[model samples]
Target: MYIILFNLLSWVTFFVFLFVLYLLILWMWGNMTAKVPFVGVPSKVLHEIEKALDINDDSVVYDLGCGDGKVLFYLYKKNPKATYIGIENSSFPTILAKTRNWWHKKFNTSKIEIIKKDFFEVDLSNATHIFTYLYPSLMDDLLPKLDKELKSGTKLVSASFHFTTKKEIKEIDLKRGRYQLTNKIYVYEF
Candidate 1:
């Protein structure tokens, strides 16, 4: 019994070590390639995001750099009829998002897609709403792509960072809450 218990404990430790190593590598890769670390939108911010977006049955929402699909999943619950797409470049977060999406599909009839590709590479022509929680510089870099692809009157909601070139139609500041790590959410119309 003691021998079996020791073997189980050793296996657990080895798996734990592998998980940590995987995360470490992913972190480094994200920083080097995307120039942004993987950070999930806080629960408080999700509320603000939902309020910022005007999703409908015909709406096609895209969450750029969607880490673990948390934002898309939350929005999916709110607007089940709307089509949701998550674009994640990092492998670990893509895997996590896909796993969560698989589980979510089992219980609901929502349309959620997790694509493991750079957001820049994907065409944004069909998106009715776009959500991003990326760095300021990256947000600036994304403006040209957004301008080129998104059709007229498309809504772009950005958390924490705003595009310098585009003027935001609405901006919400959430400083009162305890979970308010990123205080501002900007909304723009293309």
Candidate 2:
């Protein structure tokens, strides 16, 4: 009986490690293909973003290149009446976000829609609020597209990057301890 129990424990540990390794590989590959690494915004920063946006009950929020649906789900939890849409190109993050949504539905009735497609391909005309954590180059490419597509009075909240065309309505400073972070939260209006 002792030997059998030990064997079972060993097998369980082995499988757990294997699963972790598989997930790591999947994440790396997805990032490589998407050209942007999956960097989840800190919970503190997310809260600041929520506060800065002042999301309302009727706001339609879209998170372009939303890795793991963190922002969308966070906002949804705060305001369930609002619509939150997440667009993710990478497969691993999309699958992870979808699974999280499925599990989240058990207690919360708010539904967060996750789209597995390139951010460029998704439509932004109907978005009342948009959020992103993209690089400078991507932001440059996206500026004209968003200006052309988004309706007037749309709010854009970007983390770690700024848009070239639109002037920032508000900029929030995110600092921790002695180090003042450079990834300031920028809010823009269209």
Candidate 3:
């Protein structure tokens, strides 16, 4: 009986080790390789976000996570006078955002900036429109900051995850994931 118990404990420990490795892999990939936990904002959602917020050519838009800075880049393509800011915590994403911003500022007709830092550390009060693709867990840390930092009538957009407190201005299904409806954008006003 003791031997059997030992074997069971060993197996449990081994599985826990594997699970931890998996989580580490996810974090590293999200921060470096971006294999998972990093997905671009879908075009459908971007369209709706811009439309819902009534984004103008001169709007100051801030994209949290800003993976590859596609959302901000595309928005700049549409409106050249708009100021785009990207907050990316991961090295790979931040580097990519920097490269993109450099090229666009080099030749393109607009100015875009990328900052390497966690979204929670940045100030969003002056942001006319804010975009994020982060999960609900991040929301737990961000809601209070949002409540305190953002001004009245500022637009907040999230892809796939929902915050518990804010009133969602719109919800639409343009894509479906394996276990959930994906193309969902939640817009909030503060």
Candidate 4:
């Protein structure tokens, strides 16, 4: 009985290890393909984002490349009347975002819609507010799309990277004491 139990435990451990390894590989592949790793907007930056935009019941907010949907969830919590949408291309992060949304729906009256699709393919015309934390090149590529799709008076709040082609109306520098952080939060109006 002891030997059988030990064998069963060993098999369980082996399967668990394999499953973890598979998940790790999937996460790496998703990140590589998406070109952006799963990085959540920091709480401090979220606060800055909150201050940057004016969200209301009529607002439709979109978070492009919203990994794990933390930004959308945070914004939804602050203004439950607004509709929040999270677009993520990576599978792992999309799954995580969906799971988080499901868990969050238990307590909240409104739900954040997390879609596992490329941001470029999704329509931005409906978005009254947009948030992102992407690299410089991606931001440059996204500008044309934003220009074409986003309606006038729409607000965009970008964390870390800003669009080179356009000027931001407001730039908020995040600092810890006297030291300024390399990345800043930029707000632009379309």
* Whole-model Cα lDDT of every candidate shown, in order: 0.90, 0.86, 0.77, 0.88
Segments in model 3 whose C-alpha atoms lie over 4 Å from true places: 1-36, 175-181
Across 41-122, the per-residue lDDT of candidate 2 in tens digits comes to 8777878889877889889899998889988888987899998999998878888899998898888886588999988898
Per-residue error (Å), model 2, residue 20? 3.4
Model 2, stretches more than 4 Å misplaced? 1-19, 177-182
Residue 29 lDDT, candidate 4, scale 0-100: 92
Using lDDT as the measure, name the better of candidate 2 and candidate 3: 2
Q: Please give each candidate's TM-score.
A: 0.88, 0.86, 0.76, 0.87
The sequence of per-residue lDDT tens digits that candidate 3 reaches over residues 1-190 is 9999999999999999997787666557765643235567666566766665567876788988888898888777777788889988776667667977887777876678899887878888888888878878787578899889888878887877888766687775556675653557777877
Residue 96 lDDT in candidate 2:
89
Best by lDDT: 1
Q: What would you estimate as the lDDT of candidate 3?
A: 0.77
Query: 87-157, model 4: which lDDT tens digit per residue?
Result: 99888888889989998888887758999999999989999999988988999999999999999999999
